[model samples]
Target: MSTMDYDEHESKFMRKARENPFVPAGMAGFVGIVAFGLLKLRSRGNTKMSVHLIHMRVAAQGCVVGAMTIGVIYSMYRDYVLKPMEEQKALNHK
Candidate 1:
């Protein structure tokens, strides 16, 4: 008899990958746009460097907030829903 190699052990990894959705596509594009705008705003004019740094920091913070929203949504779904289902399924498997 030949040993069969079924990917039973990989279902969890696949499930977790599917369950986690971090940073929506639109938000990611906004982050890239902010970064690009910052690059354009890299002026060496009479303005103090610290002022421009603060502007960049504020834009970066907005991007972080957008990213965190995705994280929060993913966490809520994964922790409250998918996790329990996976646990139950695992128990049934055993």
Candidate 2:
């Protein structure tokens, strides 16, 4: 068996990439949309075609709300915590 040593240091770009807020927000939006769609479909019978329009609207609203909530929370965390940590790390590294 061969053993290798890995660098513990992280680059600035890599750190920034790790702090990406879009992934969580996008996933939340996708999940919200699907859940809303399922709930709407289950609650309303499929007999009426207009129900689909309502479902779409509800799903879209859920997606938008989910994405906005997640995005805002992450943005706040990134700005207040991650950036400061990165700055401290950079200073320590130097």
Candidate 3:
């Protein structure tokens, strides 16, 4: 693709990421774990590649789940805790 096309695609991706940050977080986690798993694969002496693949799959899934959990907690905190505190402060000022 041309530079302009690449930039446009990236901009669209960033816009989507901003709208739902959890997707990027989960993607980053999965990519990071997979990369790490690949790097460590060569050192596995006497271990089957299938076993390593299974482990990588599990770890990547865990990363995505962890990201989702964190996102939910943060959303809850913003909605339940921060919003109420801000509303209270506004009431106090009035």
Candidate 4:
């Protein structure tokens, strides 16, 4: 293969493997489900919110709650998962 063609192919592969800078489809669906389920409980037993509005409102609430939940969990995770490793590294470096 020519050098230019190889470079182009490698670049294309790298681009394909790159992380998406947006919420993924399954994660988005989970957020939507949680938000919709939370906001859909109305005063009337059988009433339902409009489908589009339910999804929209839930998605917004999902973004807010999801961020907060993630932050809390990440803090716990770093404390439990990384703090010991950091201390160990410090000890070894001494």
* Winning model by TM-score: 3
For each candidate, what is the lDDT? 0.67, 0.68, 0.89, 0.61
| lDDT rank order | 3, 2, 1, 4
Q: Tell me model 4's lDDT, rounded to 2 decimals.
A: 0.61
lDDT of 1 by residue, 1-94 (tens): 2224435566654554444545444356567767775776756478777787676667766776766787788798879999999999999999
* lDDT against true structure, model 1: 0.67
Highest-scoring model, lDDT = 3
Backbone clashes in model 1, listed as residue pairs: none
The C-alpha stretches of model 3 lying farther than 4 A from their native spots are 1-12, 19-22
Task: Report the Cα lDDT for candidate 3.
Answer: 0.89
For model 2, what is the error of residue 22's alpha carbon versus the real structure, in angstroms, after optimal superposition? 3.6
In candidate 1, which residue ranges exceed 4 Å CA deviation? 1-19, 23-34, 42-47, 81-94
Candidate 2 lDDT score relative to the true structure: 0.68
Count clashes in each candidate, considering only residues at least 3 apart in sequence or on different chains: 0, 0, 0, 0
* Model 2 spans > 4 angstroms off: 1-46, 90-94
Pick the winner on lDDT between candidates 1 and 2. Answer: 2
TM-score of 3: 0.75
Score residue 33 of candidate 1 by CA lDDT.
62
